[model samples]
Target chain A: MTLAIEPITPLPELHRGRSLHNVWARFVNRVAVLLCWTSALVTIGALFLIFGYIVYKGVWALTGLEFTTHFPWFDFTHFHLNATFFTSLPRPGDAVGGMRNCIAGTLVLIAMASVIGIPVGMLCGIYLAEYSKDNLFSHSVRLVVDVLAGVPSIIVGVLAYSLVVRPMGNNSAWAGAVALGFIMCPIIARTTEEMLKLVPKALREASIGLGASKFQTLFRVVIPAAASGIITGVMLSVARVAGETAPLLFTVLGSDQPIFSMNSHFPFFHADLNNAFPSLTAQIYKYATSAEPEWLKEAWGGMLVLIMIVLIMNIMVRVVTAKKMAGRH
Target chain B: MSDLPVMPPAAPLRRRANSAWLRFVDFLTFGGAFGGTMTLIGLLALLIGTILIGAFPSIHQFGFSFFTTSMWNPVTARFGAWPYIYCTLVTSLVALVISLPVSLGSAIFLVKLAPKIRFPIPSALLGKSSPSGWTLLNPRIFVTVTSFLIELLAAIPSIAYGLWGVAVLVPIMQESIQPFLADSVILSDLPLCGWLPHWHVGLYLAHIPGIGILFADPAAGSNMFTSSVVLAIMVTPIMTAIIRDVLAVVPPELEQGALGLGATWWQAMKLVIGFSKMGIFGAVILGFARAMGETMAVTMIIGNSRPSSYSLFSQGQTIASLLANQFNNADTDSERQALYFTALILLMITMLINGIARVILLRVTAGGKHK
Candidate 1:
């Protein structure tokens, strides 16, 4: 509802408007406003300052692209291994070393994680939104999901270490992917449920009216309507797990050397998911805490790349959402 | 003969086969969806089960003393978690104390103030007043960017914060804030303040050590206070976003009614906040959970030194930090099990807080319907 639009008034005249009649009331109101304004400034300033400082240090250290790429076959330093991807360990004061292996490892693990996570999370979401009735079972399931969302990442790491790493007799990318997949599941599932909930009930009814089964109605009509939201949720889940260091710390355990040791016999066909690998986030933690200035610089650069990926993903979500809204209109 | 042809019976058989195939597909897809939900529940159960089983060795060995013992001697194999637990509580509490007001204030600013001043000046009154100055300070540009900036802050990894804290904030604290506090007369000159500055309590609270160390003897700047500051900054985005969301759903009519009844904008906001108190509490609890479980940054900055001290300025070890620091190097079975115990504790705390928050949030949403 529109209120009557009044002309602009000076502070005193606005105070005169019966809403804040007394001088003390006006003073309190003004002070409250000032406090809030200052808080906004502080919060925004802190965010930009952290990002700006990282970029500044990162750009200064980014003298060469050497640190980001490694062509293992071309380098030909070791036993001429068939697996041609590895993250070279950062030697003290070594300027030539890069995180090619870490980047590749991160991509591989995330891809594996998404393959496992997305379908399961999306399916769970569909079940919650469409299939489940409001009953004791549904309530318990919801409670479980909520609690799972809050479980610490470190704990997840420990669980992975015990469950997968120990049983396999080795730390592996598969274990890390499983850990990351667990972290992604609750977030994706919850968001997907919410997104699907937003799909109009009438859409389901219309599909059913057109002689469609419940499965067809959900898959063809409701899912397409909520597709963008689900994609956003998936992207967000990937971004969330991409920066997680703790889960990977114990599971993948991080390698300094460039190694893609998944089934070596089938290089083209299989990834040795059972081998340790480096990741960008784990490298940042390792390098940042070290005393060497060179490693620290590389850490800053890695952090910069990570922040960019996360920001890009977040921005895409907004852009996609905006486009979807425009399309609806 | 026309009604009962054998060819028609053949057509019916074919249609039955197709329908049966379709039903099977439906059953398969339904099972897939159902299995996904079951998997989520199973994962949660498995994680908790693993932690509990791993924790058994430590729990069985230590008994009740596990909570009471202060020493964390790996050599003696005498593991006590009291220090780390204490550190977690102190840092999280301090972070909440610092961040809650600021986050709430920012939420209020975004929801209440920004909208009121976003309009263009009308007619000749625009130039007479200082319109440019007003818009420059409280511009639509500033408001939009501020909201987006909060989300960006949340997107940043905790390790980055740790890195920033160690590389940047550490020196600033060591060179400036710590030394300044140590030299300041506020601890010496003020009445009953000497004790107050250090969070010192008297004989009544004997469980606490003498003259609580919140501001006691200063060491290197990597201390409880520093970690708390970092945690505060880290969780502010979460707190502000949650509060803002809760505030958004508060019926505008409630606030408008307050305004119509001669209350100011700030007063109306207070009404909105009061109405959603349960939700705000839940949000703060969630933030507290975040602060307590935060690892990389707290580990990097908090110094992770042994012999835990209460001094906010002295080095301390949080449960999460202790886990992160020692997990890789835990050589013996007992040491590793003790680390598992730490994880179990941290997990329990986080889960409990989240559970409480969920309940509170449910109540808030349910209550909002009545109003």
Candidate 2:
């Protein structure tokens, strides 16, 4: 068979007008470069501006431990109340109270969420990466994970409210944890999958060649290899959920006094997890919107703590990932 | 070794028990992983199903008019979503308009103009000629630091941004940007100053030919403009990061080919961008989806008022802010149902946006494979 080839068409001449067009093009390129530089500067500057102002305004509240330890008191109507009373929730004009309960409550919520989310997410991720062999089921699961990650957090709140809070006949930390757990699941699972995918297939095959079962190979070799990435993903997921307010809005229901501490209970050691609890994020929303200045100040204090928690977790993840990345070379 | 161990194969019960334990573990782990995957699918279904079921009362009540009617009074039992939808779209649109160029420019700067960084230890660190700290002063360090700060900005909670917006951004907008635009000769002439309560233009500005300046009755603080500004800041990092990643993955050969043809650096970048337009579009849509669902900051800064406006300067409510403000305090069943309906709408929009973004991203990768 004879092969036929199409004739090449002649190309157009260059439109290199030496006078005006060249100048215009040159000017455009220069301006574009300048704008790009300016954009970088603006982005960097914006970050520092937000963080600086927050730290500047929030540092004073943070310096005192009162906000973190002192529960607010409502009835200081009698004379000569204890100085510790100053750490209680703000009265109309007093700024002495702290978000101790909120701090405790946030930790409890996160702990519960981690317990639910981490294992399940890791398992799912391992299955996706090491097993399934890119089946239609696995593809759909991956798609669903991405879509779930984008669900507006408030809708998650609403879901938790209906399923857990409403059914229980009250808002509780349990419901809040569930809502936050839903949010964390997709992030951890997807990250874990990606991290596990980066593990060498040769390692898996070698383990199998050594007569190791699939589970043993995964647990002994693949998982340990991808530990740093999985840990980083876990940290990032925690950071992501730590700042979430909308889900907790309808779930935790924000209490002023500490309710969930084990010491503050009837059994003396058991804490009530299924009760309305304070959270730093929910507290910020509550106090930030209050009519009183003292409450607003407390809100700022809560914001500082919240920011620190999130930023520290994120920075830790960054450091870990960066170190691992450096080690790869 | 065989002589030592061969004597242990006598007990059938023990051997069967050993195999049973192994089988149990095998069954347990495989089942656990499969169950975990199924849980994720179940979680999505429950979330969407609950929202839809919760929203059914209002959806049945309002039917299609829910999209058209702007009325949202709880006292009168009237609920409509035109204003909230309008505000959500307008705020997201405004944020995209403000952020797109900035993020694109910054991404281009990092991906094209920034120097390639090598994570090499300085020679002096190994007791050689170079100084130990020389790498600290590199310009690539500056770029890395900038990018780190951007990521940190992303990590910042929406509430903190809200706090900053309330404390800082609102004042700046009210004092600086608004007034600057109001007074500027060219910008002031751009129809922003005269959008009155009834959508009528100012008679004075209207009478002047080619000058349809629409000055909104400026609220003191916490307006649509402030919320949009915060939203813009909140989303810039996301857009910039995504675009940077997208551009990073664009094969250098595309640019090298253009350069080999004697094209300018700008032209080469333009060609690369042309090739990655779908990816960039996906990035923009992702950013928009993020902007639309952003809650605390927008709610805190957007002045969550009932009355909506056509102008940016007036206080407005997004669907998110509206749901946030009213969901918990909703006294009546219909009121609560209406809020759920709003969430349903927001959910559908976000899902659609993300779905489209994913499709675009897939197409970009598929196209790359062909090239």
Candidate 3:
């Protein structure tokens, strides 16, 4: 090949007419950069606003044993005021721990929902990611999951009201737990499925080459490796459901009694599990409309408590996600 | 015995049984997932069932005019949805107009611009993801919150929103707009503000003609404008988060490649980010879907008027809100069926939205690896 030299253009002077266009271009890029930053800053500011206000309010209300304990008094003067449904505290103090009862109830319902929801979601996710080979079943699951996510909270409430709450009896957390699970399942499944897909096929092949069955490989290798991502997704699902109102409204029937302990009721605790209790979210709804000062304090306090809980969960997810992302790099 | 067994093949029945068992387990696994998926679809059915049971009878009595007629006189048992439908479409359309720019802009800002902006996550978190620790210091909190409040901002429950509109928004709107009217003569001509009742409450004391403003008449319900605000708040977080995520996925490499080729930054983003046609479309569809399914919050603020409105400030009803408010009152069988049909319509809408979103998301992901 014959050797050839390319001519180089001379640099233009900054003050000349030709430079004006360059200057304008540079200015535009700078402004674009500024616009990007401004948007991000504004978004951050909004988050801080939500966090600050909730914490500021939650601090005082989250005090005493009350922060942890206390169920409201559900006086169904017209309904059944059966002693069987009621549980009394040891001390019989002036005020029940407002949040303590709710905290327990919330945990139990959320935990139960999580248990039922997470596995199904993961499996559906697995099928979508692996077995799908991009199948019709998996594709339809995506559409269904999307619809589920968008369904209004009230409609979920109504369905739960019709199915679980009506047939199985009412004024209990089980109904609420099941309803929340119905909605949460779609979100957890869809996200988990997507996250699992992001794991390279090579990793799974490596596990299979070790003479592992698909089940063992999936459980021992793929799952544990994707553990952090799944955890973050689960946490987000929790945070999302934590704010839900209508579903619980129609399902739990809004009890005001101190709920059973979270740990004790696992597997089966008939009396407590069957018992009526309040959720922090449900309480916020009930108390928002009340005329009493004491109730008002509880409502605002509950909102603060809710904000804190959701924020903490969200932050943890973000941190875990960030760490997992960095580890990938 | 060992020599004979060593050369023998395993029994065909046993092997077949084992494979069958394995297949059974797989089927079980798949079924468990599909069952939950069905529940998601099942909810739409339940909602429709409830509404049709409640509203269908009225449809029979009122005929097809049940939808086309605007008059809703309870004493005469006359009913029509002309006004309600008008109000819903108008406000939602207007809301779409106002929010689409801000939300889409915010989405683009978050996706393309967030990296250059430090503390990007916090901004997204401030409203939803994180707590409000940093926001207490910003002066914009006052401005945004006040603006939101004037708009009855954030995810405050519906009851409070309704009360605020009744107690706060009405008087302000009435006083602001009434002064421009030509007393009775000019006011009489305005169809939009025709519903304002003479009664005054809280801050509104004037007997302004036409409910053109907030408290102009305070007829119908206080929710008129209040519901629209609530709807706006309810959908904003959803829009912001989804759009942000969609934008975030637009590869930086693509944008940089354009810029490296001597393209303007605008040109770079347009080519790179704008390529996310499916995602952007999905985000918008999902946003509209969010607005459609929203019930309690919208119910609280929207006037939930018997009839709806033509004007911006009048009470209007949404399909979801209507089902929520009226589903329980239907005692007749067909009355309930009509309500169910409304719910069916709502469900169909939701399904259609999801179906579209699924197609868009799939198409985008299919193209995700491309520059």
Candidate 4:
């Protein structure tokens, strides 16, 4: 249909038809160009609109002090004045609590995820890179990783909640960490394998020539060289885990109370078992869904806080890589 | 048995007992690596197994009936997943259709048309760069600003979409669009012909044919079109991002060769760019997958009123939303099991589709690598 308007074989004939089909030709060309641009623009532009709306609405709720601090402490009179911002200081079980507990829970959960996920993922990467030979089993494993990534995190949450929280009869942070760990491992292993593969065979030969054991060569020689890529994988996984909400919702059984203690005093914080704690993402999910306007504001504020933390982590990764590369000078 | 030759030994053996300790290190490296791999594979199996078990009882009782029944009466022990599955399929498919063209278009422009984006991070950091700029541009695509925006939008709960969809979209799509189409004699006779519900008391009469075509009388809330629109926005960024990554890998030579042959840019793209249909299709499937998986975003906009929908404007229920709305409300084991069966089915379907896509993508990539 589009090809009927073809140009002439020679320049003279092409010129003759120019005026008759000039506007039509230009219009066709314009639409063709616009079609491509519009499609791309729509893709990029919609993201902008969503962000614009979120930030525009959320700005009203954000305050520097509120961001740095947990839910503010206030009495009944203050609560009446700003009915949305609720903080019951004296052991009020369920009014509106600070995010202190959630913050601690998220950190502990993340720490556990790193511990459980990293070593195993790193080893898988090595095995895939050094052994397996992309055999049927290894190929199947690679396929499984993609499938795992596609599995909705909510399923992960449901699974984790059942395995860790429901059986234990408590909403502890440990279960949530395990869920996030499951999500993180496939991604980490793939990245690690790619990095490991980049290490030249000559380096291994050099080490072997010097009478170094294969294990020592891998650990002392290959690993140190590929440290940047491995770390990058960890950093990316961390960023991903931080953004998740569904997994935490079921596993963490988030709390409103401020939990300031970083170390043990909390039995649930131990590595031996699963425990529940609050995370910023989970809190946002709860608060945003609530009817109160004040709660909505806090959800927005919470978003800002979470984005900042993720941003900082990303910057840390970038800066470390940059500095390391520069130091080679 | 074929024995692969090791690199010819180049170094002198240390004449000490400790010299062979290095070989032990090699053994440990291989052992630890394999062990770690087994643990990860075990974790994946464990996760799936755990969920399947929990959902087992429900699966056993309902069998096939669980999918067809919509009673959801926990007090009497009746559970049906028809509504939830319908909504999930409808909403995700709709969103995929809406987002696919735009995402693919954007990806092509950014890759083939737009000038290469240059952000000079120090040169040494560029270890093992791919010839394709697709992966290179990932860092750029991920500038926190984009994700930051997505994160904020993501945090907005689904209920808001419900409130907004009913309040805003139902009226706009009905009031303005429907009446304009009526005077043109578009649909003189259609079942949707009706009066719309006004905010105050009256019904504004609308005469239109199509679901999107405005009618004199507005249809009730929970139309499929409105639900799909809201869902389209939610899935757009995800689809776009994934599409962009896939597109970044297309060889520039394909486009260049087309242009060199004197074909117009558009013609070149249609022929050469379209040939990599596999990757583009993978992207749309990714969008489809995300749409299917998304819970909160579509849940809000979809009018949760049951009795499955054929009209684009009527309310419908999706499987995930149905579970969410009813899980806490379930009083009977039968009811709960029906939900589990539905979820189990959803999980199975998703994994199967994803596995197929991965295989196709791997084959394409491996072929490209070999070429």
Give the Cα error of residue A299 in candidate 2, in Å.
2.0
Candidate 2 Cα errors over 4 Å, as ranges? A1-18, A64-95, A260-267, B1-23, B117-143, B182-215, B366-371
lDDT tens per residue, model 2, A1-329: 88889899999877674657767767877888889889988988998898877776565355433423343533333224233322455344554677766777788889999998998898889778877775778777888888888888888888988899888988888999999999989999999999998888899999889867776788889999999999999999999999999888888888876654467556776656777787889988988887877677677767777888888888888778877776676
For candidate 4, lDDT tens digit of each residue in B241-305? 65555555667788789779655667777775576778667666766666676655445556566
Tell how far residue A273 is off in model 2, in angstroms: 2.6
TM-scores of the candidates, chain A only: 0.82, 0.85, 0.75, 0.75
User: Any runs in candidate 1 off by more than 4 Å, and if so which?
Assistant: A1-21, A64-89, A92-95, A261-272, A326-329, B1-18, B116-145, B180-212, B369-371
Could you report the Cα RMSD, in angstroms, for every candidate shown? 10.3, 7.8, 11.4, 10.0
lDDT of 1 by residue, B1-371 (tens): 76775553433444442366667777888899899999999998898899899989999999779888887777888898988888898899999999999999999888777653455544354344563444222245456657878978988888888888888888777765665565433333344445545432223222235643456665587888889999999999999988887787798898999999888777888889998888999999999998999888898899888635567887899988888778867878888888888889899999999889887877677666777
The 0-to-1 C-alpha lDDT of every candidate, in the order given, reads: 0.80, 0.81, 0.59, 0.63
DockQ numbers for every candidate?
Answer: 0.45, 0.51, 0.20, 0.35
For all predicted structures, in order, the TM-scores are 0.84, 0.86, 0.68, 0.76
Report how far off residue B236 is in candidate 2 (Å).
1.1
Query: fnat, candidate 3?
Result: 0.25
Candidate 3 residue-wise lDDT, A186-268, digit = tens: 77877788788778899889877865556556677777878788888888888877777667765785665555434555555
Per-residue lDDT tens digits of candidate 1, residues A2-80? 8999998766534454553476777898999999999988998888888887776665455432323433534533323
Ranking by DockQ: 2, 1, 4, 3
Kindly give the stretch of ten consecutive residues in candidate 2 chain B with the minimal lDDT sum: B198-207
Give the distance in Å from residue A85's predicted Cα in candidate 1 to where it truly belongs.
14
- List the candidate 3 regions with Cα displacement exceeding 4 Å: A1-44, A59-100, A166-172, A258-277, B1-66, B69-91, B114-227, B244-278, B303-308, B322-339
Question: Could you give the candidate ranking by TM-score, starting with the highest?
Answer: 2, 1, 4, 3
Best by TM-score: 2
User: Interface root mean square deviation for model 2, in Å?
Assistant: 1.8
| CAPRI quality band, candidate 4 | acceptable
